[model samples]
Structure formats: C-alpha cells, structure tokens
Target: MREVVPWQDGPDGDADGPLTPSRDGAAKDIRAFDGALGPARAEGLLSALELLRADTARGAQLDFELLRRSQQHTLDAPQPPPFRSLQAFTKGGREHYGIDPTTRAHFDACQAESTTDGGRPLPLTVRAARACLDVCFFHPFDDGNARSAFLVLVFVLAREGVELDGVSLLRRITFQADDPQDALTLARYIDVHLAETRRSAASLGSQ
Candidate 1:
C-alpha cells in the first residue's frame, strides 16, 4: 500500500459517472452474511455503509478513527477498540500479521494513498483494491478484519465519487501479500464490476 501499484487504467475505469444509486450490493452482501454465517455480527457493516456515505460527503481522511467507528456497532462496545497491539492470525493460522511501534503509522500511510498525492494518481480500481488488500494484510482489527477490509474497499471507492450497484465480486474475497498477481487480479475484478455497474445504471436510467 505504501508502494501504490500503478495498476493499469482502462477505458472508463474510474467511477466518475453513474453516481446515481441503484441496487445496494454491499448492503445485500452484508445482509446475506448477517443472515447465514454471522447472524447480527455483521450488522456493524450495515451501519458502516451509512458511515461511509457520510464520511465521503465530508471528505474525511481514511484513518484509524473511521475504522474504529465502522466497528463500534458490531462489537457492541461503547468504547471503540484501539489499534491492535499484538500480532493477528487469520486463515486458520496460515497468515500472521505482526505489529510494532510503526504498524499503525504504516497502515495510516496506506490509507492516505486512497487519495491522489502530488505524483500521478492510480486508477480508482487500483486504489480501492489496494485498500482492500492492505486491510487484509495488515489485519488491523482484533476481530472482524475481513469486515473492516470490505468497508475500506467501499470507502475508498465512495471517496472517489463511485458506488457499485453490485459488490458480489468483492465481498468475501481475500488476497495474499506474497502474491503480486492477486493485486492485479483484484483490480481487474473491480474493473469488471465497475463496468457492469455503469452499464446497469445506464440501463436503469434509460428505462
């Protein structure tokens, strides 16, 4: 994430259009998760959707506070959990995320890349995909890191004035830090979804 990948930009890859709301893919995915695997455990994500929209409107920077707020409802804790201090393991201990003094800072820097810096900007697909991967690799949350990763991906796109009508391609997907192809694959998958979303919205508009 600190080294943002220059994921190739394709025609109309950015989410500057079809801002019109259509089907809520993220919410639908969340609802499915809530109903089946998690029950109300994923309810926080529903609230996070509202938070994402509100934060996007205010142009809030993607940081730890936003992440903390995203988890408040799910954890049912009045006090939001702090940045995870100890190491985090996932995928049945197949993955281990280490932490130290600079871990949170590194995560923050990765979040900052969601916006364009002085350098050339990455495609929205790349940025969003990167955010999703960063959350996965960093494993910032004590629990529900996957949920947070999903929200971060949506938040990154929402920041760029794009909203997907369908997120089934992205929901529940995991990427490996060791695999470079996974990053590119994610960006491409996002491209596919974005194209479909634009087409879907255009069709709805014409009807």
Candidate 2:
C-alpha cells in the first residue's frame, strides 16, 4: 500500500513533498556496502536488484559507485548530477516563484519529506518520471530545481533498475503532451512504452 504522507498543495497548484520509506542512514549504509563490494560486484548487485520491483531504500542501499554503475544501465554519459547541497537545491526551487519565507518553508518541508524516508518505490517507470516532474513543476527553483529534481528521479529510479534517460523523458513528454495535464499523463504513458520497448528488444535479440 502507498504510505500516507500529507501532500499539501504545492505553490500554484503543484503537489507537495514525499511521504514514503526513509533512507538517510540506509542510503549511507548502501553506499558503504557498494564501496566494500568494489565496482564489479556492486554493479552486479545493482543489476540484480533492478529485476526486483521492490522499495527505493532497498535499492538505494547500494554504494555510490554501484549506484553510478546501475545508473549506467539506463543513463548515458553527462548525466544530470544531483545537487551538491540540499540547501542550495531547496533555495533555488523556492526563489524561482518569488515565494515568501513561509511558503518557501513549506517547499523545504516537502523536500525534507522526500528525503525523510530515504525514498519511495517507483514501481512503474512513468511514475518515477512523474514524481520528479511533479516536484520540478510545483517547485520550479531559480537555480537547479528542474535539473536537480530530474537527477533525483533519474538516480532514484535507476536504483530500482528503471534505467531511463531523464532528458529524453523530459523531451518526449514536453513535445508530445498538449497541455500540463497532458504532460503528466504522458509521463504515465512511459510505463507502457518502456515495457513494449523492452519486449521488442528482447524479441529482436531472440531473432
């Protein structure tokens, strides 16, 4: 069942923060495990985990290098990097809308919620993209909100083995969708698209 986390209305009708499994210490531990396992083993473990549609924290538990390797399964080079400082990413997101401190606090609150429970399970591919898109659209930061959120979605989902190109999803959704709602809907469509793509690729290999 989807865990209950109060998602308040984001600024300008956007959705609020994450309310799933916490992963701060767990994420750190995973990184540690990755380091201990070294590159090849870490990558193998991550690849194995991707085949399981489990939780985000379970997957994020891999080491940084392993996480990076897992990311390689889905992402190309020049990946959008996660924000170095949480404060910087949050500040940029809030300032973009010229929001006041109080409202900005709420944005921070939501951001904190996302990280609170390490992360959530993005079982379906499109949902993963949608989560990040929702965060970016609702919390369009002045600095790296879009890029940061995109990276988060990419990395987080990659942990689960949904190796999608963040930029490509953004491009496809923006170009295909007629409106905002349409855009969000298009993101959902990616799930079906990915499944079909994988199926076709497998069939081609068999042939």
Candidate 3:
C-alpha cells in the first residue's frame, strides 16, 4: 500500500517555508519510474515532477501554483509549463536535489568512480536515501531541501519494497526538526513511527 509522504511540521508547528521540486528537466526520466503507466500518463507524471523540482530548487520552497498547474496538466488539461528552470538534473534529479556546489561535485565524482569500480552498488534504501539527505542538508541550495531529501527516501523505500503515497514521512521529519541537531531525533521518530504503523496495519489484515 502507498504511504503518505512524511515530514512537514516543525517544533513550532510553523513551516520554515514552502518547498518545490525543481523542474530541471527530469520529466523524461520521471517517466521511467512509472513502468506500468501508459506512455502518455508516464510522460505527464515526469513533466510534473520536473516542474515541481525546478520551482523548488530555484525558489527553495514549494510552488503551490506550479504544483497545482502540474496536477491539472496530469489530468489532461491544456496548461502552461508548470514551472521553468535554468537547467535539468543530472541522472534525473539526483545531481541538483541537494544544496551545495562543492558537495555536488564530490557526489558526482564518487558516482563516476562507482560506475566503473562496480562490485554491486549499495542497496538503494541504504545508500541513496542517505545520500539524498546528506546533499539536501549540506548543500542548502536555497530551497526544497526537505522535499528533495524525501524524494530520495521515497526512491530508496520503493526499492526496499515500500510503496509511498504523496506524503513524504521524511519530509515531515525534516520540517519538524528544530535544526540540524534535531534531524537525528526526527530520524529516530521515523523509524519507530513507520515500524509501529506497519505493525498495526498488518494486524488489521485487510479487515
């Protein structure tokens, strides 16, 4: 079952700011994620994610207007570009998801080495989610750090056999954290929360 995206609250219960995903050209790749989707629908989802990412990266906050437009586009309505950006993400959204220039360089360098040095890559859950979080937090590219971080977690969880819905649990944790120190606390909260929720849901056994 799909789970809601997590992490949108802060200790004060006031959001730092809105978050938006950059539209830096991940639309094509986004389609790849939806293997079961019809070609047209997959294309549309990719476009939406791209637009969302673009607005978030540049503005470092959610573009409610862009997101709304993207959703409308998904519904097959004629719409303007959901958002615009200066560029597209490398390896889809992987390159631009985080916040720092130098850190992004290091990540790309490591990824390059991994490509040829391949043994087997780390499982997506273990490696990618953490990677995304590290970049999102450290790079601080002005916006969408939490959302990008959550997307990485979502990808990892999907690889680990979890189906994520729209709400990102990790996103909520990040939003709730007081600062960097509080992020560790949020991580712990997520582990316990998800495990307990799963257990409870399992006990219900499809009613």
Candidate 4:
C-alpha cells in the first residue's frame, strides 16, 4: 500500500533527541485538571479513557475490536462500528484514502505488530506511540478517529503497566504521518508525563 503521508528523512528523524515535553505549560495544566477531577465522574473522553484503562488492566489485548469498542464508548451514537467504510481525511484535508482489500491487510498487519511484543525491536513507549500514530494516519473510523487514537496509546501504555501522570501533550497535538520524528516525539511526550506524575507523587509523600 502507498503511504498516506510522505516521510522525509532529516536530523529530526535521524537523531533521538532528549525526551521532554514539547510544552511544559500543557503538562502543568493537565496535572491541575486531574487534581480537580478527584472523586468526580469521568464523562465523555475521560470516561471512555477510564473504561479502556480498566480493560487494559484486565489484560485486554489491543486489537481492532478493542478500538471499535473505544470508539463506541467515545461517541454518543453507536450506529457505525469503529471501521470506516468510506474514505476519511484529517482536519487538514489529508486524505486517508479508501479501505480496500489492501487497506485491510495493512491494518491487520499493524494490529498484529502492536499486540505482539516480539514483533518490533523498538522500546515499549516508542511501540505504543507508533500504534497511536498508525491509528491517526490510518483514520480507521468514520468519526472519533482522534479519540480512538488517544485511547489506543493509553491502552498500549497501560498494557505494559505504564500510566501517565498527565496527558496534556497527548491530546490537542497534531502529528505528521510521514515524519519518523513524530513517533519519537510522542514517546518523549509519554515519558514527560510519567516523570511528572512520579514527581508529584513523591511530593505528596513528603508532604
């Protein structure tokens, strides 16, 4: 299958830079939001994330069906399953192309690689980030693709017993499908949140 986004090799993709949050302010904001939501009902995206987290904790394997359920929970209506029949596109008019026989095979390969640990030689965070990016670029669902992608990332991390303290950068960020740097950037984003969360917990313990 042809690539949806054309990747250009460069220093950005060549070197694995220091893993840090792209925006420190966003991480702080996410922390504040999480702190404020203590003991409250998680509605909408939060609710769906919580559900997916629980499933992951229960050893749910990451696959297409899990993604469909995530999309179903994310949307108000469940008329359409997670898979998109027609051609979809990003908000910036990046066409996802149509899902034909070739597309299905490509997606299946992605799923298999994502679930199996021996499939890729990359670090866990990078692998998880790649899965998330795959969903974003693939644009599998007719709607809620962004949300679905976010949940997939969370599921990947949770499956490995890694949950972020904050998700500020994970949300509201656009990734270039063709850039290999995007994968590393996302892994760094995850690391930033995890570190911050650990720091926060340590502070609480000392308090």
Candidate 5:
C-alpha cells in the first residue's frame, strides 16, 4: 500500500503569496515524478488524464461517476474501487469526519453544487480548488483519495480551457476540512500555477 502522510505544508513555508517558479521549483518536481514512474504506470496515468480532459472539454459537469471513472483509470486495478465504506483519517490522527452513513448522499450533493453556478458566483479557479479540497477532506476512498482530488481539480480547470504547467504545490499537502482559510489558500495556489502556465505558454508562443 502507498504510504500516506499528513496533509500539512512543507518546511518551505506557508502557501500564501504569489508562488513563483523560481521559488517553488514545482515544475521540476512534477517533471521528475513523471519521469520516475515506470513506463506502463506512466502511460496509464496519461490515459486517465486524457479521458478526464476529453470529458471536460465536451462540457461534462463534475460528478461522482466522473470521479469514479478517473480513479478507475488512475489505479489500473483489476476491479474498479468503490467509495470507501470505512472512515478515513489524515495528519496521523485527524479524522476526515465525513458523514459515514450518508457519505454517498453527501458526495452527490457536493458534486451537484460544484457544477452549478448558484448563489454567489465564485471564480473558476476557486471552484476547482474547492473541489480538490472536498475530495481531500471527504477522504472518500480507501487508498487513492489524493490522486482523485488532483484529477478532479484538473478536470475543473480543463473544462475552462485552463491547464497548469506546474503542480508542485498541489500535491502532498493536507488541508483542514473546516478551515475557510485553507480554501482560500488553495484557490490562491491554483491561481499561481495557472498564471505560471499562461506565462510559460506565452513565452513559448513568442519564441
């Protein structure tokens, strides 16, 4: 089984402020991780990401089924994993505290609200970041919740035609389920990566 770590900021510092490519070196880390993965597993992940990209490009909304399919591809396991029936925890002991009996119902409601633009209109990055946070805090799966959350974030951004070139900050960090500030911080992180990606693309286009 994959080792799980607490979802907390690294020693580098808090994730606030404008994240610069020079400061975070996330692009390198992402590239390194991709390179280190064996060919078969790497191809599997790429296929999964493409599936998500295609679905989002076609205007599919964020939903549990979509996530399930994404996870299925991500794991490449014999049978598709189901939503975790048992409670999950992170940070060593911080329980996800999701409603166990009605977890599926809660997930359904969350997905519905995520795709719709009701109430106060939130920016696309904020919505995408929040979706990732939800999956993190919900801890919906037994083993692959983190990967699923990342894919969900990617799908959210892809739907808007935005892709991040750097995903260093997005991974290996934990968030508090009830912390409003964490939500804002995640949104900021998304914006930082998005900005960097746009800048890189523009630079390449000019070259």
Candidate 6:
C-alpha cells in the first residue's frame, strides 16, 4: 500500500532528517531475484510489504499470522498454513531448526516482543535485527522462511517509520543462528543502510 500522508510538520520535526520511504528496498530485492523466483514471489513480497506498512501506519500490533497472506502469494501455502511440526534444515542442511508442540507458542512470544517494551526497551535496531533473525532461525513457514525473515525486518523498521532505499546488505545473505556475532552483524548492516538512506535523502532535499 503506497501511502500518502501529509508531511509531519508544524512540530519539532527535523528540517533535513525526515525519514522517507523514498524507494522500496524490499521490492528492489524481489525484482533482482524475479528471473529465478518468478513474479509470484515479487507479488508476494510487495503485497506483504503493503500489509506491514498499512498495519504499522495504523498502529496495529505485529502478528505472524498476517504474514501467511504474503507467503501464500509467494508460494502455494496450505489453507491457513499451520506451523511446521518437523525439523527444518537450511544452509544446505548444515543448520537444523527443530520443533515441538511449543514452537508456535515460542514464535508468537518472540513476535510480541518485537514491539517496544515500554520500560527500558532495547534499541529499535537490535529489536528489528533480532526480529529478522527470529524468522530465520525459527523457520516458521514451511517455505519462504528467508523471505518472511526479510519482510519481518522491514516491518520492524516500518513500525518505527524507517525505510531504506537500498538493501544489498540485508538480502540473500545467510547467518548462523548460534553465532554470537550474527545478530550484532545484522544490526550493524541495518544501521549502515539506514544511515546512508538518511544521508541520500538529505542531500536530495537540499538540491
């Protein structure tokens, strides 16, 4: 959903540091893989992004169930797609994600934490990065778990009103769930792109 809200002005808004979605980094990543993944994946990612943006724009809480809509668009997800009960192995079967009766419950708990804590909350960057990794490591959906992870990252940032114009560092890269540095690396990646996006936007606004 491409939104068109009046500028946030007449208040203590930054004259040059206004966050703008100037370009769709998620869509760009999908397009780059369209030749291999096809148009359905593109449609799924784009539509899912719309859902995420719309919900965040209206202050809706983040929910994993909403992501099934996008997963269905990208791939043939079973009706209401139940969470996987079997173990999932990714990264050429090197990394294994096990599941039990409580897996779904754990996932929901993690998603609920994606929002602010309202008391000594973690920085938005860490929360967003961890949210992305949750989907990656949780391997929630039977398929498209990577795509789902990426979307969740975007959703987290969108909830905080941040969008990047480029996403080269965020996509198609594999991270280890057990690696201590992976989360830090991801947060750093998001921070780097975000800083550049703000810089580029400010430069454009000045011209």
Ranking by TM-score: 1, 6, 5, 4, 2, 3
**Best lDDT among the predictions, by candidate number:** 1
Q: Whole-model Cα lDDT per candidate?
A: 0.78, 0.38, 0.38, 0.63, 0.65, 0.72
Clashing pairs in 5: 7-174, 8-174
- Poorly placed runs, candidate 6 (over 4 Å): 1-18, 76-78
TM-score of each: 0.90, 0.39, 0.37, 0.73, 0.77, 0.85
lDDT by residue for model 5 over 9-34, one digit each (tens)?
A: 21212123222232223324434665
lDDT of 1 by residue, 76-102 (tens): 668777889899888788878899999
On TM-score, the leading prediction is 1
Give lDDT for model 2: 0.38
Error of 2 at 99 (Å): 2.4
Give Cα distance to truth, residue 32, candidate 3, Å. Answer: 26
Error of 5 at 67 (Å): 1.1
Per-residue CA lDDT of model 6 for 57-176, tens digit only, reads: 888776667767656655644555667879999989988999988888888888888787757565666777778888888888788888888888888888777788888888857788
lDDT of 4 at 30: 32
How much is the lDDT of residue 151 in candidate 6?
82
For candidate 3, the C-alpha RMSD (Å) to the true structure equals 14.8
| Residue ranges of candidate 3 with Cα displaced over 4 Å | 1-102, 109-129, 140-142, 164-169, 173-183
Candidates sorted by lDDT, descending order? 1, 6, 5, 4, 3, 2
lDDT by residue (tens digit), candidate 2, 75-177 = 3324523322223324334333334445544444443333325454223343444455544544433243443344455444444444431233342243211
lDDT of 4 by residue, 44-160 (tens): 456567678789779887777777776666674544374777877665686445677677658757855655467324555666677888788777877777767877887776676
Question: What TM-score does prediction 1 earn?
Answer: 0.90
Candidate with better TM-score, 1 vs 2: 1
Clashing pairs in 6: 1-50
